[model samples]
Target: MKELNSIPIENIYYMLCYSWDKLDYISRNKIGIEESMDIQNLLCRILVDEVDILIKKGIKKNYKELNESSSVVKGKINFKESIKYKSTKQCKVNHSYDELNENIIINIVIKTTLINLIKIEDLSISNRNKVKRLIKYFNFIDTILLNKKIFKNISFNKMNREYKFIINICELIFDNLLINKNDNSAEFYNFIEDERKMAYLFESFIRNFYKKELKGAKVYREDIYWELTGEFVEFLPKMQTDISLEYNDKKYLIDAKYYKKSLVENYGSKKLISGNLYQIFSYLKNNESKSKKDEFSTGILLYPRVDKTLDLEYSMDKHNINIYTVNLNSKWNEISKRLISLIK
Candidate 1:
């Protein structure tokens, strides 16, 4: 709701984060981003521009007493407001930063903003030539790029139709790369962008460690659909769908969560905001049914694997609802391998 020019960087972060949640799986997963790279960049740029533009308007103010700073930004930032974050560990790391916290709000806002601005064209064949490399692989790059490139590339748009093949190739590479999070730039943001990123990371774990030389059986990822019927009927409106591992016709759901290890054993009812186990129970009840017999659906409430050491299980009906605790303090890739072995 708050335009880039008229709001604080945090507001923009909130917007991008909220918008990132609404995106489809492909858009959310293709890029390893807190707000999914492109939105992160674009929103960052928009906010920065607003800050700059507002500066030109001769707006000047400081909220150091209240600890605010956007007013100090040339345009859209409140550098003073971010004073609270000055002592935060992040401020001490980047050399591009200062100890004074002059632009704590503006600088972080800029850094992350730039981090999100990777257009297909930017991530394309020209600047980095990643496009040419990507073309030799996946085919549906264009569609994925269309979702991230909220801007236009005059050169890409003007290219001869024949180059469409190369363009398509670039798109594919970008999408595939996004779906994979091995890039250094991806390390710029935290992994809490949205449920889909969490979901993508979960599947990536399966492919990276479980798939081995056999990586083509991920059809269940795409086969999952939002149906108004079946055991998942009541939640059809809100349960944000479920993750499935479909081999032939057998589909299993992998519902993920980003929970703190200290608080991982309680039901997600009002009493327990930190721990949420029944959330998976609800999904299991809604997603797994008898008729889906050939395809069994079990919900996995994947907490960001941590050393909290509290693993759990629920005896709901006859379903062996597994409430597994992943140790995020170390790594998250093992959840899949662990699940595969546990179920095997």
Candidate 2:
């Protein structure tokens, strides 16, 4: 029964930024929300509040085939595709109408929740405008398919790829509502409880942030081949670093770790997670060494700052290994600067 306002929009943004391929569009668009707003109202705000940016970046209309019984001939028509004539002879001709595809189903999926929010008798006056604006956006579409069956049948494909992020957010809002349907008070939405999802988001955000900001370096999130040649080497576990930055001769292998506790007790003393360090070291050894002592790389295990700080550095085996933390809770500008400063 926690309040919806407690749900952090940052988590949602992180999830979107992680799954969505278009980071430039998402990074540029921002929306403001009150901390105490419920998920339904927050969703409404996302739709109505950011509609302009969402429309500009995504939500492009496509020419779609529309079946209709028309008075006048329209776009390419099928001679045998008329269902009305088989049932009953009517003067009206059945033909295919080519119209700019209406994303009504998506619009309905978004607005339905807004309507539900408005129906709540105890809803606050402050959120009324949000609901109204969401409804207005729905009206902007060609049609509003209100049936849940239609919404279920509709799917996003390459044709409607632009709306991917917006649709994703809408799906989250509806899925949460369905799970908590028994609660009449319209309590909290548990969208952030997925730890695996958060880990992916954190990893992806770090990778993309570096790619966007680190102009001098080429960043990649890929597997590093161990010096194994035989086919059996494929069976060996794949070693993929969260990020690998290469700027001329300097190489930095970075692994982003998302853990509730950034540090662990090792031998009765606090230390960086050994497995993370081992993984990064493995990547550095397998890929960067290349059988030459003069050729070396820096391995960094970067973690989001939690309750403790871990800024440790060690030089061993002709490589520099660093354990650092970035305070994600700080302003995003500061976070970006911290990430960019890693290579410097």
Candidate 3:
């Protein structure tokens, strides 16, 4: 992938929204997103804007069980607790009741993410103030120990579906922000330095982008079975595609690769990464073997444009293989067009 800083902030925002499959929703509310802002500030702006809208629309409420001492018997009354606390004599009952409240996990994550964003030194004064203002609206929501595992516990239904976008941003903030224990200072981790995370983001962005943009095409990740059969075949690594598209009986299996260098330099000549080529080749051949389709399958090794653009084509064993690069640093429209043009 191109250096995160080098890529336009707007492009980064678009990539993130695409990865989360929230491009349309975000595009409709693009008030705070700007091309000039850095990634940290950009994310903070998005959170602040979205949270403000959420507060106005009324934060999502869920039924939470609360244990309280009350004169009225609401839910199930804890008779033993009432007697132990001497609330029986006071004419009060210890009862556990479910109350509709905004103190849910999704709101808590937003609040916690906002609090952490404030601690980052790179946050602009304007954005920091916006974050603080947005946090005030979340006063009714309780903050929790922010961790990656917290995201796993959250489930989205129709009522709370809007929170998915904001929570995704929160997860990104949680994953990338580095907080100093000594001074309580925080810094955003340079995303370009983390190849693993960038790879995931790049792959997800490409898959989702195609899923949304490809007309009448079935876009999904497909599992390719090995052609060879063995007694211990289970021990073999599963072959899963990054992005697979089927349009008009033509199959295209795309392997999205994000690396610092797109091509490997050997001796004096540059060559396509051998492992990537081999992997995509295996996916095409195995899938073709299983389906026995009359038309040959095409395999694409798609990479983010690094120092140069590459469009290499090859024909091997009746399978068409194309190694291409999409320039992420280009204009958004150009980037979209380039990606669409890949399969064509």
The top-ranked prediction according to TM-score is 3
Q: Determine the backbone clash count of candidate 3.
A: 0
Please write out the lDDT profile of model 1 over residues 1-344, one tens digit for every residue.
Answer: 01111223332332233333321322333332342234334333333333343335533222332222332333334445455557663342111222232222222222222233343233422322322332222222122223335222413334223223223323322333342245434322323444455445444543333333224434233223333447756565565433445544444455555433325244553222323455555555655443563224555555444444445655556455565654432222343345565435
How well does model 3 score by local distance difference test?
A: 0.84
In candidate 2, which residue pairs clash? 5-36, 5-37
Q: Compute each candidate's TM-score over C-alphas.
A: 0.36, 0.70, 0.93
The TM-score measured for candidate 3 stands at 0.93
User: How badly does each model clash, as a count of residue pairs?
Assistant: 29, 2, 0
Q: For residues 87-140, what per-residue lDDT tens digits would candidate 3 score against the true structure?
A: 435878889989998888888888888988988987999999988888888888
Q: How far is candidate 1 from the true structure (C-alpha RMSD, Å)?
A: 21.0
Model 2 per-residue lDDT tens digits across residues 250-313? 8788888867777778889887777887887788778864534225888898877777667789
lDDT of each: 0.38, 0.65, 0.84
Candidates 2 and 3 compared by lDDT, better number = 3
The runs of at least 3 residues in candidate 1 whose Cα sits more than 4 Å from the true structure, single-residue gaps closed, are 1-236, 246-251, 261-276, 288-297, 328-336
